[model samples]
Target: MKPLSPDVFDAAQALWLQIRMFAKGMLLPWRLNQLLAIAALFLIAHFAAKPIGHWLTTWLRKRQGWTKWKLRLGILIQQRVRVILFALLAWILVAVMRELTWPSRSQLIALAASIATAWAAIGFVTRIIRTRLLRRLVRWFAWIFATLYFLDFLTVAENLLDSLALSFGEFRLSALTVIKAVVVTVVMIVAARLFSRFVTRKLAKNSDIAPEVQILISKVLQGVLITLAILIGVKAAGFDLTGFTVFTGALGVGLGFGLQKVISNLMSGFIILMDKSIKPGDVISIGDTFGWIEELGARYTSVVTRDGREYLVPNEDLVTGQVVNWSHTNDFVRLDLFFGASYRDDPHEVTKIAINASLSVKRVLAQRTPVCWITGFGERSVEYILRFWISDPTAGITNVKGQVYMAIWDAFKKNGVELPYPQMEVRMLRANRDEENAPHFQMTTSLKD
Candidate 1:
């Protein structure tokens, strides 16, 4: 090779001198200047970056007319930005180390490692920022990012790894293969998130469904997006989906045995959703278990009862059992109060009083119009049936009944319509002498058998 330029030689010599100085400082038993210098640099960067990030974030929020949540969100973003900036500065210091250590392959390798580590750090911070954007947006971001970084770090470390492999007369692998896999995986995840957000936003814009339903649908869409993303990531990881047909048999066997209940419930849940028979917020009664439908999972439905207990009913039960949807077509529910009045009271008058009593209740729906009828004639009383409807079922049936019955009690007392008790008439025979004497009178009329 031609002799290097004078400038290059001088630069090389300077780098060599810095490396020698650094090594000597490390070897010195009591030298503290190098350590203090490094610590001072880190502290300066940390304090300076944090305050600057905070001021910048505050200014941004003021300009954007941020809400309390948004301001808090911005503060979190600023913190993350500060950390990332500090990390980048640290990496730049390592690159400076490589420059001062002369042009050696190991120095270049260390520089590359530092760059890879810094890149992973940036990605981790970005994921955290994204997760914190919405309220409690799931804290799984750190785990996922860590896994991704490990995979990427493994890929980037392949060069030194393959050299070791070559020393053992083994096969060599390129770092590019591993790096490409990580890049493609990251791209897939980002794409999935974007697509999911777009679909969820679109679904939320539809006003027909309840808010909970919209949120549930959005979650389902996100799950589907993630599944698709996984498939794409697998493809990017150098796996050919078409070549993996042999795994189908294994998958089928797993589904047949291990995942039977999961598959069954999932299918049943889909059916329930499509039929629109059971939905979020519906007040459904399944056997003795009655509650508002809080969530519909793949295998079970969560019902939040009035007592604040949540019941998880299997999806199959919801489809197979008798479900009383109190608010099926409408929120109107009718309650019947059966009362029996004294036989001396006129049947027509009893019916009129019952009707008026139902009308007096505030919860009674005027549009439905309360109805009363003389349902039956008993030995001691005439039975009256009062049927009335109310609009809100989630407020409960008992409360409505209480109001109507209270009104009825008041009306009956005012109208002098006494609610009769159960009564019976009985005849008793006297002793044998009296029975024989009574029978003697009838003996002439009829002969005993």
Candidate 2:
């Protein structure tokens, strides 16, 4: 026998040759029989899986008085019943082949059956994983592992992966190490997200916790958990964290310059939450954007306007720019409207009519009663201010104000109170000259009869 080359590929090839030679040494007739038996088993399992799965699903669904656990089990069976049935059949065939004395052929048949069983099981398990990307990833790795195991080349594959190394500064990483780190990190991140959702739901159910506090706590926990997950994954991958101190310093510098606004928004969000200045459901107006707070996030606040437009306002602007919180402290908001009536109408009577008109609006809060006051006396009309209160600002401030104005119009027209408009008066005069050098005064007029 010739010695095999020292290269990894050469060694793998040599191992494959040895296995093939051993298999060829088995009895030709018995090997053919085993092959035929394995083929028949596969065909039987394939043909039978669907009908058996359908029957099991129907039975499970038809059962009465099913508990939550039983219902979940039934759903699981319904989803993967075919795969489960096929796996069972393969495992049984593998057991039957194992009891045979055909040595090489029996081992080969059993290995194939075992691989089929493992594939089915992997499919079943991966189906339960919710994330589409993660499920696909898991399936790929599972098949790769099964393939290596069946070929008896798992150790050789591991060695090959480890031999492909890259050096960075004082540290070195192999393909295997990088893959482990990525896989572990992804798994931990997904787990953290799931746990965060669970905790968020639990916290939200507690009525005692303020909404801002709940949001803050949830965000903080998520950040800490994800950070921990990354660090743990890196450590598990056998990398030295100390080597990245300089890199981290550089990253901080980059963040300071490039992410200044991002950091400012994050801090501003925390400040808003801590101060309870702005929160979800608060009707606010910033610059031209007038809307209710739909959500408060780390970087931005979602403001949904009455026109059905949603604007993402950066948290920094909310903190620095002028903001009108209509529902702050309480939902009751007082609105002031100014109108003028002709000076002919009595001021007292106009005030009374205005108050009554404001009161006619359904949104006007009765407990805080609307009041009308003489704000000023204008040249053409008597100016008055109507102060009214509304309990729901989010229903809209402008809409209610318009309603009040409309009610006032109806009231004024019915009561014969006329609205004033600008008017101009012209006067004519004649003067006589008293002195000899005085200029003559003249009036020009044209008349038609």
Candidate 3:
């Protein structure tokens, strides 16, 4: 072989030295003992995790009386404990490995912090997996991981975050930004969860409010929370307050024009709530439409008609127009059924039969006795009115009326009362003939006839 050049020989010697250093780095003089210690720590942590999980699960179950759902609670506690113990084991192992690399307390502490952060990262991932469907929980974990990753200054990820957070003037932050972010994140999460819980409970308990109204409240709560979260995030990012000043006038103007109807409806809804006039389950009549109030939305009301068609009426109309609430004070309604009989039938007997028929209907209120009135006399018949009371007006007055009419038909047939139809009379006179003309039936025949 030809002799190598001097530069190539020097390069080959440097490469050989680097490889030896790498092999030395991998093989620690204390590797066997350190590995044994790590394995022992892991076993200890694993055994400790079980009792810790049991204690936590038992405490939660007994405190909340969750004996029926104990399995679910136990799983939650187990997961948390497993993550914590595993994180501890990982840190101890990392510290042992780092000491084997370079024995120093600072190195060990740094290694432990790095290992703990990695464990937190893994825990974050598992939490996301467990709460895949829960968007809020996922977002919370994401924020927590982001915070931890930022605090991980000893790790390579911390430099990356610092660089990213410094990329733009808007993203740039002082030391104060981290503190603000932490405080705001904590406050926002707690507030949003608490607010949602409170509103849900309130909505479930309130009976007088319509479903639509409760839904509206829920939507408002969600919007408020999201807005607060955004504001907090913005402030935490160290943006100036002056940036939002322009939105104030624009928001006002938008509300004045774009949201005028919405505001009107909202006010009308509040009025409806306070007045206690039109509530869920109340039968109401407005114009030609009549139905039971199904829901009350912020901008409109849902009325379920007797025909089962839902009508969305604007809230402004409810406040302005006359609405007949059948169940306002009580669900009682009095309706009249008019019938006429031939003059030949005894009026007293006809009235008694009609009154008895009204009382015989199942829905008719017996306490409010049915009244029979000799309303008027027509040329062909004597008209009678049967006025009856019913307590279930929400079922519509027609059903009760039909029942009463059917009963009356039966009673009249049994009693031999003659219900009369209209009759008319006609008279004719022959016209007298004058000299010029005469009205007559003419026949083309012989003149002798």
Candidate 4:
């Protein structure tokens, strides 16, 4: 084997000396007592934690008028009671031992207390992070770092990480830098998203703002905040932002070609939102699809139809194709009903009956006043058209039309108006009864009621 490098040799020698010193220290009576005392304190804390945790949970439950924040804090503290108690007790023992005996005798207890303290504090603080995997990883990372610092091995770790590096003309990147970059990036992005969401929710509650405007504001704010966060995080982690211009340009070019439709839809979505032509809860008809607008997404708009099926219509279609917004200005919709009555019936009496029948329907707008007029005279009867208004179009138009038809039928039946129908008459000429099977026949029609 080649001779060890100078740095490697030095590190090995330092580690050997530390091991020897640790072995020597353990042989002393005071060090052994110190170790035993820490072990006993940890044991006592573990056994006492169960009862303390139970009691704390009960106490919090019994308390009245406590804020949710305070209750949550108490629960978090209760979960780490063992570590917290051990840290406190160990420190007190360490202080007393130092006062009564040599300070060196309590150093082991101090180290234990220091580690326990870091564990309890970091664990409690990390509990508030919502993502489960991220929270666990952060806790582990913090614990390891704190442990290294307490053991005076943090500098060693830094040197190790720094040794594994790539150097450019003026910039150097090491493992430590990369780790810090990841941590900072995650922190900044999460914080930005949370803040953006909170502001969006507050904006949503304002009745003065239109729905599309609210969405536009939310999208613009989220994009800006995330962009700023990324830049700030990269700079804060000691990376030069100027170095990414060429890469960003190349990425932009690639995205433009690869995501043409996606970008178009996104842009179209923004246009739709800005124009305020369509909004949530608006009943829109595109192509053959008709429904209430559920949500506006970057790529598509969610439309839920009367049949309970949801259609994801592309934003491009909404922008390019013809869209009919039924309730755009107001909820009022006018529907037409056509029917004919016998020629013998008076037109004035028929119009009056039709109007009264339309008014009797529940969905027909009584305030708007339904109207009936003689559209034209049919071949055998008088044709009439009834026009009526409805306030709610989303409840459906077909059912309400059927209701009006039924009302009109009932009203006409209750009165003396006769509905016209065609009557068929057949006259067959047979040479004799023998020709009845293959008879020459004449067909005639009559329009009568």
Please list the C-alpha lDDT of all candidates, in the order they appear.
0.67, 0.81, 0.69, 0.88
TM per candidate comes to: 0.61, 0.72, 0.51, 0.67
Q: How much is the lDDT of residue 309 in candidate 2?
A: 100
Ten residues in sequence with the least summed lDDT for candidate 2? 440-449
For residue 119, model 1's alpha carbon misses the true position, in angstroms, by 8.0
The local lDDT score (0 to 100) that residue 397 gets in candidate 2 is 83
Clashing pairs in 4: none
Q: What CA root-mean-square deviation does each model show from the true structure?
A: 12.1, 8.4, 13.9, 6.3
lDDT of candidate 2? 0.81
List, residue by residue over 377-441, the lDDT tens digit for candidate 2: 77667788999999988888889999999999999999999997654444454446654654444
Candidate 3 structure quality by residue, lDDT tens digits, 242-328: 755878778888878998888888778767866777877889989989899997776788999888999998888899889989888
Best by TM-score: 2
Following a full C-alpha superposition, what root-mean-square deviation does model 2 have from the true structure?
Answer: 8.4
| Candidate 1 lDDT, 157-276, residue by residue in tens | 333323332111342333344445555665566677788788768877888877556656765776787777777776776655675576877888977899888778877887787777
- Rank candidates by TM-score, best first: 2, 4, 1, 3
Pairs with steric clashes in candidate 2? none
Q: Tell me the spans in candidate 4 whose CA falls farther than 4 Å from its real position.
A: 1-68, 71-106, 123-139, 167-171, 194-211, 258-262, 285-324, 335-358, 361-363, 371-387, 393-449
